[model samples]
Target: MKMRARCCLIALLIILNWAQQAPATEDVPGVGSLPPEVLKLLQDLNRQYGPDTVTLVSWLLDAATHSGSVLTASVRVTGNEAREDGTFLVFQIETGLIFNTRVFDQSGRLTVLWSKILAQAFAHLDTLQIPADGVMIDLLYHHKAFAETDDLSEHVDEPGSVEEAKFYFPGDPLRAFLGKKLSSPALLARTQVFINDTPVPYGAIRTETANGSH
Candidate 1:
């Protein structure tokens, strides 16, 4: 009888261990359950890049829309169907603002391709009745290639690297930046550039600079 009781105790302990190790389930919403505008934007992106290539990886929405209140969405593109492979696209959901950090070509520079992608996202987001003035763009630049699992924050604070540039502008300034006529200097003048969380003058970013150095 003691042996049988010991066996039952061991079984109980095993069951308890398994229960502790099991993942807890939460009521997380699926991609399809996103807001109608957001869902449409994702669908349009998927169609543009081929079916099942674009996936909504993560998002944070504002509890209530207010100035400086931000909603962000992180999207991943799988396969080489588009030039955005291995890159994550982050969007300001409220303002239709978007940007990506991945360097697309051998030039190792931010290119017009980003502008085009931003335009596409903005077109869909413009339809939403949200405050455009609160829209801001925070761009991350790095010499290293980002793996699919890499966290962006890890690179932002790396010493000696000017990894971030932020711009606070309404739709018109953004439009001007996207337009061919507007020069980068004008955009830079309004931009608040940063290096390792330290603020730097916009002029520190030069056309010929590499590795985000002045």
Candidate 2:
């Protein structure tokens, strides 16, 4: 009887070990259908800013112009709700102030910029130490004018007259003026905006004058 009982226990342990060694069923659905660039960008962003913080907002492989394709993504900063990582991801409905670092998709080759934005977002999270319940109440306050005017990079504190002073009032319309007036790619890249001494990201300020030069 003792020998039979010992054999039964050994058989049960072997079954348990077999169960532990069994391969798990993969349930990743619909990921194989994504574009090569999109998949690559997703993986890059995930590595930069923990998983699920960056999502494929939109993609246009053929934008039907000189520009080849356009890829848009969002990097969540903070919100009232909580994510699985104990952080909140929020998007504004009234204003398009979703991500902290916004890169204009000009030539379909700004995947590097997308990764930079995700990194910046994670850095912001580390610097701020924002709580789970914290909402981004200051997003609109910082981005109100630019959101209304579609300006790429502008500060909130600068006076509206500075826009007129610099001939940048009604932002998009002034691009043509600057394109003609300042037709040097080297100069444009060096020209510093007053905000953070940060020149606009490459491809963010594409102009007809400086189109093929760079």
Candidate 3:
């Protein structure tokens, strides 16, 4: 009797945890699960890179429509594939990525909130695979408070302003891929650039003076 009770309790806890970590469908059904454009982009990405190289760098969510819409998605790592030799996929938000070879068997595969994953991914970048549709990849979404931008007021406190910064990016997906391997906090901390605050003609500074210190 005691063993049966323990098993039942464990099953109940697992179900509760799953429900909390991931909702049935989209958080809000009417919102329509990421716009057509967004879905197209994700499809193109999966088709192009085979879900091994493309990643979600950062996600930006806003209270719009019924619930929220993925505003912008940023991808940090990209390649035809993770490289024949294979490479590491870095997260812009936190650190590590959870990998699932059989992604579809799992419903909510993308779930992880840890900084250690970030450090390890970067460290062992040479040998790792991005989980496919059925595969699972842990990410840093719950600990969003650690990121400065989680709070609007806390944004832009780091160094540069968004407008002044110019970054080499494939696309911004902070809004599209929040809890996935491609999106990471650490990568975002390094990638985002406030372009407005940047000096005009940054690389092409005029050499009017001999020093060229513009």
Candidate 4:
């Protein structure tokens, strides 16, 4: 009888251990269930990169709507589909948004934010397939705290002003991208020009030479 009890105890212990080690869906408010594949991919991404990547991904998953008009949905990462153009990952941000990719690409704010985020965590990812929707939706509406802006135009010093002039980027998403890629003033200054609908310029230097007698 004692041997029988011992065997039962061992079986119970094994079950308990297995239960403790099992993986579960991450708890995110307002977010729906994530596919097992997506959860696994997220773990891999977090392990390879860091928490920032995870945080950004989490926000994307949890975002439900923007401005009460644009709809958001749970995202899925599917296997790469081979193509002659290039290899790419298909991130289906829900079936609803797939047709609207073109609209979203037009917004300056959204494009800047999306480009910056991708560069930080997914730099190695050369090609990506998102929803075909052409609207920016509400990706950054509530996450503005993460978005930053520097209006250095007002701080530009006059010809004789003692104050040092500064370069400012008015775009919030650009600021976030700069904050991630640039660690020093020199790097930021080097990237002062970028092409948009037109050439956007930042920073100006005024030089004066003393008169010389012939």
Q: Choose the strongest candidate by TM-score.
A: 1
State each model's CA lDDT, in order. Answer: 0.33, 0.27, 0.28, 0.30
What is the C-alpha lDDT profile of model 2 across 1-214, one tens digit per residue? 2233333223323322333343324322334544556445544433443322332111110111112111121222333444333333332211112222333222221222122321122222212222232222111111112344444333423412211000001222223323443333433354322122233354454333555231
What TM-score, computed on C-alpha atoms, does each candidate reach? 0.31, 0.20, 0.24, 0.26
Clashes of 2: 0
Model 1: clashing residue pairs?
none
Model 2 TM-score relative to the real fold: 0.20
* Candidate 2, lDDT over the whole model: 0.27
Which residue runs of candidate 4 sit more than 4 Å off their true CA positions? Answer: 1-56, 63-69, 83-86, 95-179, 182-214
Better of 2 and 3 by TM-score: 3
lDDT of 1: 0.33
Cα lDDT of model 3 by residue, 11-110, tens digit: 3233333333555453322224345664444445444444333322211100111111112212233332232333333333212122222331111211
**Best by lDDT, which number?**
1
Error of 1 at 114 (Å): 8.8
Sorted by lDDT (best first), the order is 1, 4, 3, 2
Clashes found in each candidate (C-alpha, N, C closer than 3 A): 0, 0, 50, 15
